[model samples]
Target: PSTSLLVDSMVKKGLFDRKENPRDRRSLCIRLSEEGESRFQLLYNGMKKRLDSLFGILSDQDQEDFCRIVDTLYTHVYTK
Candidate 1:
């Protein structure tokens, strides 16, 4: 789905709040609502816990290699 559609859906669900952008009158500022913030924290904590558990099984060198591989992939995908 398009970004606009996703944002609209979130807004409709009261997960996001939009307000007039002071920097740009023509555009609006979009931010997570209180509910969104709470949900995000929960999701973040859960993911962090899972990741910590998974990483705990890896050696220090393995973790370093994994991070390097992830950085390379991110750069490749995000850069033109």
Candidate 2:
């Protein structure tokens, strides 16, 4: 029911693998399964295509202005 339990179950089911981090070799690394990678890639591509179509009306300058506006809003809100 909890996240740790869910992660444990997923590990048992092999949807992810726990490996020793090569850089540290002492800490654990949660690596996605082959199936997980395939699913993730498919979902990512689908979302990206949808967003691209939605924003396609914007010119490059418009996109840049939107990003700056969003960043300013985020900074103002978060710093408040």
Candidate 3:
């Protein structure tokens, strides 16, 4: 899907607020609304709980290794 379409959909759903950028008239500043923040927090908490439960089946060493692998992936993606 196009980025503009996604942004327009989100704005229509009241999940995001789109404002004209003061410094650049052709640009827009998109931010999450309060409702979006609340929804995101709920989603994050649910995912965290599910991950915790899943990871609980692993041994201490395995869990540590899993975390290390995730950290490495995150760093690789963000630093590229």
In model 3, which regions exceed 4 Å deviation? 69-80
lDDT of 1 by residue, 1-80 (tens): 59889999999999999899999999889999999999999999999999999999999999999999999999999997
lDDT of 1 at 71: 100
Residue 59 of model 2 has an lDDT of: 99
Q: On residues 1-80, what C-alpha lDDT tens digit does candidate 2 reach at each position?
A: 59768778878877788887889976778888887787789999999999999889999999999999999999999998
TM-score of each: 0.78, 0.69, 0.80
Q: Give the TM-score of candidate 2.
A: 0.69
Candidate 2 lowest-lDDT run of ten: 1-10
Candidate 2 runs further than 4 Å off = 12-14, 19-28
TM-score, prediction 1: 0.78
lDDT of 2 at 13: 77
Give the per-residue Cα lDDT of candidate 3 at 26. Answer: 92
Ranking of models by TM-score: 3, 1, 2
lDDT of 3 by residue, 1-80 (tens): 59999999999999999999999999999999998899999999999999999989999999999989999999999998
Q: Choose 2 or 3, whichever is better by lDDT.
A: 3
Clashing pairs in 1: none
